[model samples]
Target chain A: MSGPDDMQGDMPEMTPDEILALDLALGALPREERRAAQLRLRSDPAFRALVEGFEADLSPLDATTDPVLPPRSVWEGILAETAPQPVRTAAPVSAPKPSLWNSLALWRGLGFAGTAAAAIALVTAAPQRQPLAPAEVATATPEAPPQMLAASLAGADGTPLLSATWDPLRGTVVITPAAKPEAEAAGTTPELWVIEGDKPPRSLGTIDISGPNAHAISSQRIAGLQPGSTLAISIEPMGGSPTGLPTGPVVATGKLSAI
Target chain B: MHGPVVRAPASPGAAELVQLLGRAADGDAAAFRDFYDRTSAKLFGIILRILPDRGEAEDVLQEVYVTIWRKAAEFDSTRASPVTWAATIARNRSIDRLRARASRPAAPLETAHDVADAAPMADALIDTMRGAASVHAALAALEPRQAAAIRSCYFEGLTYEALAEREGVPVGTLKSWVRRGILRMRAAMAEAGATA
Candidate 1:
């Protein structure tokens, strides 16, 4: 594939269709030209084929570029817009004011240092911490209106181990551990599971034990999350349960409740 | 000369991606998330090539994924590879943004000159090197000026007028260069496909 072809000087003229297809594929046409090409694309199958051929020819170049990891916010934004929205009652008569749960700054500040219990406490006390005037409340109804469900998992002795908040609208569950899991010290990892009734526990995947872990729930699993569903943490070998069923001892479990 | 490289089925994960997209079309959010995790970086890289600004690239990346989610059902595996289909969306969105903007920043024409060089592939895309190598080989077969013109227009998302102005050439001449480049590339790729 290397070495130049000898047909440079004898190159044939590109027909008008070829020129238009090339220009369209290259995205080099001006607005007016593009509109015309688009029209042809819709009405003319032959022209569209040429364009597709050009697109396929050019696409390999995309693979020649290095990959770049986009910031997490981009994925968050995508989930916000595309995640399935659960059926709910109409907006509250008095819309809820923006709270710490809605604040990115607060989340960033909490980072990994803040305990899950402390975060839950802050969420519970957020209204009092920053009391909004009636006018402010009326004006501050967040777009999409935050719908959050939180669960505070506790060890057998009733000691809070971790707290999780599920924002269905955002399709994410933020899990904050109060401290390093005992399993982490024992060469095993703590895995989160969602148990809904008689069905086997479904792994929500291994989560970061050291800090706040935000796991995006898939649409299928998001449906399983509700007020009564139980969230449990289990100790599993390094990666997580290999059999899809929890093989480790259940360390903590909690029931999700609407916040 | 090296034997012709097969173009389609560039990545081994192509079939898995097809399944993921099918699942996403069925409104499986988990499958969609899996798809996103696997493809976002590659799409982001494609978008960033055209829109150099990180903020702008990120915005396009978000837009691209949303489009992918919405249009997953429309994906025709017989027509294009999974990465190509997604990359086309990324490139088109980024180019649209580039055209809408008043000034081009970040990806200058000079930077696009390096496009023929082998780029480091993401771990998920390591299997695509054969396809990329064939494309590089095809581009390498063109006249330097024609190859450069095509690369600049593609990687920088430059319109004929913009690229012509930068190259200090007439728009018609620039179009001729690119059109000829496209034809030669198609021929070269066709030849490679046949040999493979």
Candidate 2:
């Protein structure tokens, strides 16, 4: 029976005219009309493949570029401009240095001095961070300070899809909702995975997705995700894939580039 | 030769970070201060990639942080974390700044194509704030041929056909090299204990 969790590889493909219509539906329309066209085109595999082809053509855009960081005071200048008018112009260079929070991130970066945030947190949180069962491990409390996330893994082509800061030694991997191409976001669950040390990718669970998208994994759950593995996102069903073979198209994929 | 000493400590969670960013958005000078400190250096790195020169990059960096403070309100908490949002602002601002600068008597920017061949996907590619070093380190681990193919495609602005010609391989072979290289890299990272 075609119940839940069954794979549907037998779907029919799209025809040339219909494919063109779908392409036009997406390409030559206002944002509102495009959204409508997307709905119309969803049932057509050929059209979906066409769209997927476009994404394939564009994936190289995600390749990681090496950006050289500048002095900390420069950012101070930027932020100082945001202060009230009087504060903005008058806030002299004697700005109070950010507490450990400011310096915390510097240590986390590869170009900077000091150990990784994660390594530092281990020392402080060792007393509290107890090991747990696998499933429970998925939602463990982080030993690192608050401000760090676990989304800094690289996608395909060694492109980083996340960034981070450190809090009392734990690293933060900045994660955003998987930015789906136009006409995406319907009936798809974007799930994250971590691949460490040749082990098959383990599920890091689903990102919140959409506007309210939240990065799910933090320090407590980071271990289950595995480090140094490529982080990937595959478009699964509403919940996720049961086969674990990346059944749906991969939305974005990156590896864990530890800096 | 000495590199920084290190240990693998734990990382922070996104939920907590959203809250921190939320505070920064609400005029928590401390939060803004901390965010600026944490992200500016990385933002500077991103700026330098596009802008190159030190003075110009610093100027752009300053403008980027200003934009972050003013636009923090527009941030969709779920859409992007503080770092990603900040970095995006920095990157986009840098691109714009670079465009303006180049228009001031340098080579044209809109040469053969406008920006990266694929922008949104490229955003997914180049613009992602996934930790820079870890991802690059993984890329470094790939076979030279495979890595070169991927890098050329992503960074050096080489078309697959162009890459094929340079490598003395068929176009299809070049494509396969990039694809396989990516897959192999993924496989390698999986072995490296990577998590999302």
Candidate 3:
């Protein structure tokens, strides 16, 4: 029987550069060179794509090994670690504070006192928080409140350009100008877009670099604010992208993920 | 041009995995559990290959899933399939652990001994995953020695020097085989439309 290796006679030879790329992909390079190649991947798109291609090419090798079932407790441990920590509330009080260390009411009162102090301190520190009507503030949920997503958007070069956080409950996307190359920030306003799987990019709103970076867009307006979507920032005109689509070079991109 | 290649056996459940990852990213606990059940075994196997110690491998596997939980929103299906994306994470994490442990000198001998007796059986290496048949076909195309070098380097996270020493070949010869083997395998996989 003609074995599979027989077909290798016709296989084309790989160039030295191709071999080096393959070596880098296999993690077979010497220590110093491997580190150099990995650093290059961060700043070089062509190099990154080449490495990624090797990853994709060799991924099938993973299938050859049988899956070994992990212990069930591992899953439990993951859940325990990843589960959102509930904000600790003050313990219940059976009676009024009794100046006794063991009394539940004293401890509960102390907890409330500390919480109130921290809230006061935070409110004092952040003067930018717009004061809400007491009536509107009272409508906030009593239970575990909805959390927002904050992502640090990076460019293809892996440099942080803008820090963004979208609060679904509050209907706001907060953008903070970060360490971006000067050329990227010059001559254009930064516009944000949300891209879901295979869907057209939708504009969330323009980010005001001079003013508060927070832009108010309801969750109803942006469909892909959830996970599996990407939050990309592109340079645009003062009013935003005139064509309603990202027209300029994408300076930074980050996928919308849980904080 | 290497365009997109369809992964045959595209069941709704497979597609649901991507959606489930999305929900898990939203901190939906149930969806996260389902994602773990579907994926953890394969990830565990990948980690175990590098770490050798079951306990350490399990620990790394746990970290991998947690990273997935935090970064599932970053799982762009357009960029990579779920298994490939996850395997990359597992491999990278395992490599990181391996590097951290490299300072200690107790590992090489034990790992070399294991490699001596641990040639995987042909049948044991086969699986029903969609790309397995194609990959196996391409790997089968290599010379047996070339294939072993590739497998040992990949599965065990062996460096060229380690693999060369273990196989009792000059480092240069082994490098030649590995590079040539990889090129042939890539060609065959591309022909099979299995290259990413």
Best by DockQ: 3
Rank by TM-score (best first): 1, 3, 2
Question: What would the TM-scores of all predictions be?
Answer: 0.56, 0.35, 0.56
User: Model 3, B1-196: lDDT tens per residue?
Assistant: 2333444444465567778888986769899887787777777878877887877887778767766776666677766666677777787667645644444244642352222223232221222255667778878977888898899888877778878887898777787777667766766766776444
Worst 10 residues of 3 chain A by lDDT: A115-124
How much lDDT does candidate 2 score? 0.43
lDDT by residue for model 2 (A54-97), tens: 22222222334433445667756655455555354555655643
Chain B TM-score of predicted candidate 2 relative to the true chain B: 0.53
A81-147 per-residue lDDT for model 1 (tens digits): 5766723357663554332222211111111111111111111111223777999888874444355
Instruction: Check candidate 3 and list the clashing pairs.
Output: none
lDDT of 2 by residue, B57-120 (tens): 7876776666555445546554344455555455444543432221323323223121322212
Candidate 3: stretches off by over 4 Å: A1-21, A30-32, A86-259, B1-9, B103-128, B194-196
lDDT of each: 0.66, 0.43, 0.60
Tens digits of per-residue lDDT for model 1, B85-173:
77777876677566555567645533532233233443436545556677789789788887888988898778889888988977777
Span of 10 residues, lowest total lDDT, candidate 2 chain A: A114-123
Residue B111 deviation, candidate 2, in Å? 26
